[model samples]
Target: LAKTTQPISMDSYEGQEVNITCSHNNIATNDYITWYQQFPSQGPRFIIQGYKTKVTNEVASLFIPADRKSSTLSLPRVSLSDTAVYYCLVVKQAGTALIFGKGTTLSVSS
Candidate 1:
């Protein structure tokens, strides 16, 4: 697995957009970028994923540059309820066990 780099924490106000960036300089060609959001004492939930370019769903958008060395997870108009730890994972292949590192802590204020 590739190691990811992210901010230890971030702060935002309600109705604000939050963008968290993660870097994986050693990412493999077959690796895909995946983002997950985890609340207190709960399992992480998949937010978005992509191999290159961009991918968007109802909850968030994932942007990957051509180099594929880094990715950004964009959340639009976040609320207090959106506060959580966000993780960026590099999945090299299917059936790989999920390994997690300390994720970015996002605090959304009212």
Candidate 2:
């Protein structure tokens, strides 16, 4: 599995756009970059995913560079309800349990 590094915390006002970048210097070719968002008590929900280039959904957009060493997740018009922890993970097709470390906590204020 590939290791990812992200910020510990971020602050943003309500109705603002937020972008969180994660670094994965040793990503494997079969690895896919996946982003998850978690609220206080709930388990993390899938946000977006991509192997390379860009991928976008209703919730967020994932951008990956050619080297595949890093990716950026962009959230548009974030609100207070969006305040949560965001995690970046690299997973291969093989079945394996995800080991989550401390994620980036997004604090949305008014």
- Highest lDDT model number: 1
Flag regions of model 1 displaced more than 4 Å: none
Off by over 4 Å in 2: none
lDDT of each: 0.93, 0.92
* Tens digits of lDDT, candidate 2, 49-82: 8999999998999999999999999999999999
Candidate 1: RMSD to truth:
0.8
**For candidate 1, lDDT tens digit of each residue in 1-110?**
88899888999999999999999999999899999999999989999889999999999999999999999999999999999999999997683677688999999999
Backbone-clash count (model 2): 0
Which pairs clash (backbone N, Cα, C closer than 3 Å) in model 1?
none
Going through the candidates in the order shown, the clash numbers are 0, 0
